[model samples]
Target: MIIVVDALNRHLFSDILAEMHALRARVFADRLGWEVTVKNGMEIDEFDALNPAHVICLDDDGDVVGCMRLLQTTGPHMLADVFYDILDGEPPLRSSRIWEATRFCVDTEKLKGRTTRNSISYVTSEVMIGAFEYARDAGVLDAVAVIDPVMNRVMQRSRNAPYDYLGTPKQMGKVKAMAALMDCSEERIAGIRDFAGINHDVFGSDDEVLSLFKENNGSAGNGSREITLESAYDFAPEPEAVRKPTRKDLREYCEAQVASAANDEEKVAALALKLELAEILRGDVQNRCDA
Candidate 1:
């Protein structure tokens, strides 16, 4: 399934983001031969500082397999800041309703199969569907993506071909790169789903996503399955169907987390997460209180 992660909830999905960063470093830097900053095994750039919303596809095993970054075109983006040269003499496209789609990559090494319209790869189509739906829901009407010729072809095969080109394709790094405009409408999303034959919701609900993460406590580097939160806080994860957590349950969970914190930083982080959790569990709390 795909997870839509923004700035507010990014801390909650730390494990997934870490895996995506590592994957980006592998795809953009190691394989694609792009000039990107890779620090501590993460492909992070100035745009990351802007806190763009990430549409990430996690495999059935809850491992990140595909990911894309979305940023508003009204603000600073790659095409405006860095790749403007590729635009040639044409003015940079900027609009409030438009967003820039970049870092569009998937776990090619793992998937191995060449992602194409003919290839029924769940992760590939799922990521595209996730991205377009995310943009359309946020009132974004279109997106500009900087892609290589090969990816452009793949995009065409997927039945979501670019409607316009910013400029002629120019060589960048080891391949040719150009900007292509993509419409973010229901029609576009539907066409992609039609090609992939996926007709269901690709995203899980907010609570469902959080519960899944709580079940996965593996650290960033090591793959060892350690119950990070459960051990640190001393409680089983919130069962999906059992019952929603009450305000008291949330408070106790926060207390346990803060109490087990090794230092002030962790304590602060835990409390911040607690406040967020309090908001999420408010309805559950109110119901229990009324009972």
Candidate 2:
């Protein structure tokens, strides 16, 4: 399912937003080597402060598997502020009816190999559908996205190709970036729907969306299943606490971080943390045996 999170209701989806930012960190900063700011394992930029609407894709487990940030072009946006170089010296497009989409990414580590549902293809289409539809309903006439040639091809293959290009492609970091224009029309939405074989409404109700977070808060949440050094400190026990995390919990957290580390620095940090935790576990076991 998909959820459109805006500034008004963003408070309600804090957890989802966290996961989304983390996912962006993994994708852009870690995988793609984009020069993005990643703080505490979350990728955030100045545009994010503008309260742009986020179209998020949630898998059956209610995890934020995919997401995209949408900002109105009338104000400060990526195309205008950051990616103006892609405009080939032309002025950035500005209008109330046009929006800029960016930071489109998916959780490739989690949603891997599957052909449907949680697959990369599925979430990509789902995010696109949610983004375009949400913008269209809000009286947006078009959406401009900063994309690479690879993403452009993916958009073409998925029947959601941009109708036109605004400027020449320019090298940005590891890949070439260009401004692509896509209209928020029913025909384009229908084409994507047909290609993805998605017929039902993608938007989730407020009650339905909130219910998933309730489930997350009750359990250990995604924090337990996928742990990082940043999260390790966050989940640490209080000084006065009597109980500690189980051995299995510690092991899983360490192993997950080691496996999912985005870069060499992260991997080295995870390994060191894993070794430190392992030593503690060994000491606890030795004490129990001696007793």
Candidate 3:
């Protein structure tokens, strides 16, 4: 099966929306026996239009089989809107730098065999990589996912421990649980860089990291087995080496980041330090730029 990842833009919006509705109807109503009604032959809500979303399309002998939706946490998102009850209304979602990963569905009929689990794993990994790439480009520092316990375990094992959990799994339904937070640190970035080294042609360019963030946004948070990375330093650095940012460039980036934060005192304070570091870097750059 070939998987095509597309950004949720005007060109592909209608198709993705339709695909989303069909997948939801099949998974929720048919498979899980949920009581949700399918209207206008679509399943949608307010959150669907908010934030940028990515859609994953599967080609099974030229048929669209599986799909998912991923949204970045920019404004009122899943943490505050949908999963607030599970979080006890005290989760640190308000000022946290996180992406909300949700809305994952697959075509069971097309993938009904011993390799089903592995196929899901492979697709999930692709989605995750897409989500990470999106977050990085948008300057999102972290991600929060609400997933089923079983699927969480599968995700955790697939990554072989590439993430850290910020909260205990909150059981919401029979086979599901709500959890949040994942690692997207510089260390994790390094690991990905290394992975792409030997398999450069397979993973595409370095910028492909942004796509992972976009594609995986939906499934990033849903029910899955939890996995954690054993060590953050497992991967080697790029052969070309990373160049340090000039102080001016650093300062500009930091200021832009600071300005983007919401009116949260704690968030402002935390970002202030980052801004200071950028300022110092800027000073260094000034010295060099002037020289």
Candidate 4:
């Protein structure tokens, strides 16, 4: 599933962003041996501070398996700064519609056995499709990406081949890198969908997105795993479903929560207790009244 993080809503996706930066560090610095900066095992850069929109691909358990950074070419993008040498010294292409796509990485080894068309993994193609769709929807004309031969082949096989190339492929670590251009058009999106055999929307539903955040706050180091009743949002006294809280029960529950919490978390716990007790009352109103 694809989760978009832009300037306005970036704060709502802190956990995902942190995981994404970690994934980038692993894919770029450690795996690909790119000479990029890493702090606390996160590959965050200046452009990230620019608040560029990120198309983050999540696995079944909500872990970031793939991602690509999108930044306006008019700004401090790699093509205009870091990869300017690859432009062959003509001039860096700068335009509002032409965005620079960078930090395109995926968890290949982590998702090795994932099913996809053409015997390739799904995360890679899904990430590419999501990026183009995101750009196309946002009125982007085209995107210029720095990719290696391996990724180029993957794009070609997935039927989302780049329309043209820039200056040339330069030696970047053990791989050869080049700037490839692809349009953000209907035909390109359709071809990618066909190759991936995906006929429905590429993004996760609202419930899925909500579950992702809840899962993160409810668990540690287990993003992709599903939340069980025993672990997440469940402080029940028994296996049965919780009912609405009676007024007195809710008052006592709130009091207990406030008493147990010594810090600002008491306010949070009080609110949570009210909500939970409200559920208990909602479910057991008739039973409580009869008793």
Best by TM-score: 2
Kindly list the per-residue Cα lDDT of model 1 for residues 144-206, writing each as its tens digit: 999988888888998889999998888877788899999998888999999888899999776
Clashing pairs in 2: none
Off by over 4 Å in 2: 216-291
- List runs of model 1 lying over 4 Å from the truth: 113-120, 210-291
Tell me each candidate's TM-score: 0.71, 0.75, 0.57, 0.72
User: Cα deviation in Å at residue 138, candidate 2?
Assistant: 0.4
Per-residue lDDT over 1-291 for candidate 3, one digit per residue giving the tens place of the 0 to 100 score: 223344434342333335555567778777877655555444454555443464454432323445555565435565555555666544335333666767666666665562532354444444455556556666677777777776666655554242655445565655556665666665554454343332222232323422433355342321131221111112223222323334444454455556655678846875876867968767988999999
Better of 2 and 4 by TM-score: 2
* Candidate 1 local Cα displacement, residue 35, angstroms: 1.7
Taking all chains together, the TM-score of candidate 1 against the true structure is 0.71
In angstroms, what RMSD does candidate 3 have relative to the true structure?
A: 16.0
Distance from true position, residue 130, model 4, in Å? 1.3
* Cα shift from native, residue 122, model 4 (Å): 1.3
Model 1: per-residue Cα lDDT at residue 138: 84
Per-residue alpha-carbon lDDT of model 4 for 1-291, expressed as tens digits? 888888777656666777788788898899878787676667766667666899888877666888899998755677756676787865556556789999988887777765653123577767778888989888898999998898899889888899999998898768788999999999998888887777878787546865875575464443553433113212212312223333654465466556545589767867786788778767797788888
Error of 1 at 28 (Å): 1.3
Candidate 4 displacement at residue 96 in angstroms:
0.7
